[model samples]
Target: MPLHPFLSKTKLYKFLKTICKPFHVVFKYTEFVAFIDENRNKGKINDYYNKSTAYKNRFQLHDKLLEELKNKPIFYYEFGVAGGDMIKKWSLTNKVETSRFVGFDSFEGLPESWENKKEGHFDQKGNFPDINDSRVSFVKGWFQDSVYKALLDSEFNEQCVYHLDADLFSSTLFVLFQIFPKLKTNDILIFDEFSSRDHEFEAFEIFKKCTNNKWQFEFIGAVNNYRQVAFMLK
Candidate 1:
C-alpha cells in the first residue's frame, strides 16, 4: 500500500538527512580544508568546522552515546542550553530510562570573560523558549558561582552524565570539582567547546591530575564541530 503523499515526503527527507548529513559535512570539510591549504589560511578551516551541524549531530547520538552510560541513575546536566536544541534532539533519539536532563545557563548571556578569548554568542542575556520536555529544566545563573552552590542539592548528586558547555575555564573547573564527588566509574562527561580552548582543556587536565587515574577517560569517535568533545567516563 502506498503511503499518503505528505507522510512519504517527510519520511523520505528524514531518511535522506540521516544518511547524507555526515557525508555532506565531510565533503564540505574536505573542500574547506582544500581552500585553507591552497590559500594558506592558517587554521580558519577549523572555525568553519566548528559551525557545522553535521559535526554537531555526530556528537548528539544519544541512543548509542547514552546507552554506554546506562548502569547508574543518569542525569544529563548541560551548562549552556541555548534554545534547548541539543537536548530536544537528544531526547528524540535516546532510549533513556532513569536519566533526567537539566540545562543551566545565565540564559541571559555569558558571564564576564575569565579567559583570553573575547568572543562568545551570548553577548546579551535572553530568555529561553518554552521547553516541552517533562525531564528537562532550565536554571538561570552563572555556573561558576551559582550552579554548584545554588543547584547541587540532594537530588542532583545522583547524575551520571554531565555536558560542560560553560565556555569558560572557571565554570568547567567548577563543574569538575562540584560534580566530582557524585561521579562514579560508570559516568560520562562531555565538553561542548573544549578541544580548541586551551584553558578548558587545562581544567580537564587539572582534574585528571588530581584523581590519580581512578577514572578512565576516552575521546569518543571523531572530532565534532572541531571544538566539542564527547568523552566516555569509565
Candidate 2:
C-alpha cells in the first residue's frame, strides 16, 4: 500500500533529509579516520570508539534512570526482542520494584525484506528466549497486529522506555506510529539501527514530520559505531 498523500510532499520530509545528509558524511569520514588512527598506532582500535562503548554508555544511562525511578512504576518495552537477550538482562538488573518489562516480536521474524535482504531473513521459527522473570511478558506477532491489539486493549498507559531493534522501515514505522501518541517527556527510546538510512532513520524521519514537531528527543548515547542510539524524549 502507498503512504498517505500528505507524507509524500512535505517540507518536513525535505528538512529531515537535509539534516540527515551531514550525518551520513560524518559516519563515512569517521570510519576513514578510525582506520588511519588504528594503523598509525599499530594497534587494534580501542573499545572507546566502538560499539562496545555505545552499549556501555547506553546501559549506564539506563541504570541512572532506573535508580532515579526506582520507587516509581515504569513500563519498559523492547521491540524486536529477538533472542530476548537485552530484555532479560534488563528484567534482572532493573531496580525499579514496580517496573513491567514487555517484549514484542513476530518470533517468525522480518515481516519483509530490508535493504536488499530477503523477507523473513531473521525468522526465529517461534523460538524466543524463555525469560523466567515474572515482570516480563511477550507479545507474539507483527507490530501491526499485536501492537494495535495492545493499544485497543489499553495495555499501554504509563510512561515507557522503548528499545527498538526492529530493523526494517515498515516495521519500525508501524511500531513508532502505534506508540508515538503515548510517548512523553523523560521516556527513553533506544534504537538498535538508528543510522541505517533506509530503515530506522527513514522511519524516524517520517515520524518526526508526521507528528508536526509536537515532541522532541535528546540524544543520550550510541553503540555499534552509531548503528544504535539512545534518546530521551523531551
Candidate 3:
C-alpha cells in the first residue's frame, strides 16, 4: 500500500483534522462572499424585497407567486416542514382539488450543525405535523432515507413547486438533485434560506452547474432580503 494512503487511515489524520477544523468555516464563508459577487447578475432575478417590518412572513411572496402560477393545480413539495405552517398555507391557498402538498422533514431536526443551531435544533420530538386537510401529507425522517422512496411512490408530471427549506446544504441539495429530473417547464423552485451562503446558496449554485445549462430559469420573486426566492423553469 502507498505510505500516504496508509497514513490517512490512521489517528494522525484525525489529529490533522482537528488542527484544520477552525479554518473550515472562515474559508468557506470567504468563498461564499466571492461567489455572491461573481453570480450577482448571473441569475434571472431583477427585483428583490427585504420586508423589514414583517421579515418572517413569507406568505407575501407566496401570494405574488400565485400570479405566476395563476392559481393552477399545484404539485407542491416542501422539503422542511418544521412547524407545519407553510403546508397549511399552501393547502388553503390552492384549493384546486387536484393540487397535492407533500412535506418532508426528519421532525428530529437538523441532520448536522449549521450556522448557530445545534444538530437537533429543529426536533419536534418525532411528532409529525397535524394538518386537517386531506390534500396535505408529510414524509418523516432524514432526506436521504425518505426522499427517494417518496418520489418512487408518487407519480407527477405537473408543474412542481419545490420549496427547499431544509436549512442544511446536504438536505437541500439532495432534494434538488432528486426532483430536478422530474420538473417540467414552468415548475417553480423556492429557496427559504437562499442567503445562507455556505449552505443553501452553495448547494443551489452547485445544482445549477451540474445541470450544465440543461436548465433555464426566470427568477420570479423574492422576500425577506432574498432570504426566500422563487424561480420558474423555462
What C-alpha lDDT values do all the predictions have?
0.62, 0.73, 0.80
User: Candidate 1, residues 33-61: lDDT per residue as tens digits?
Assistant: 55335433222123334444564554444
Write model 3 residue lDDT over 1-234, tens digit each, in one string. Answer: 456875576668788788998798788777766744544564434233333525455677777776556478878999999888888778877888888999999898888998999999888998878888888988898889889989988757677889998888988988889987688888889988887877898898899899896777677766655677788888
Candidate 3 clash pair list? none
RMSD of each: 18.9, 9.2, 4.0
* Best by the TM-score measure: 3
Off by over 4 Å in 2: 1-72, 154-158
What is the overall TM-score of model 2 with all chains considered together?
Answer: 0.70
TM-score of each model, paired residue for residue: 0.63, 0.70, 0.80
The CA-based lDDT of model 3 is what?
0.80
**Which pairs clash in the backbone of model 2?**
51-224
Tens digits of per-residue lDDT, candidate 2, 15-46, equal: 77888998987876575455335433221111
Ten contiguous residues minimizing lDDT sum, candidate 3: 42-51
Candidate closer to the true structure by lDDT (higher is better), 1 or 3: 3
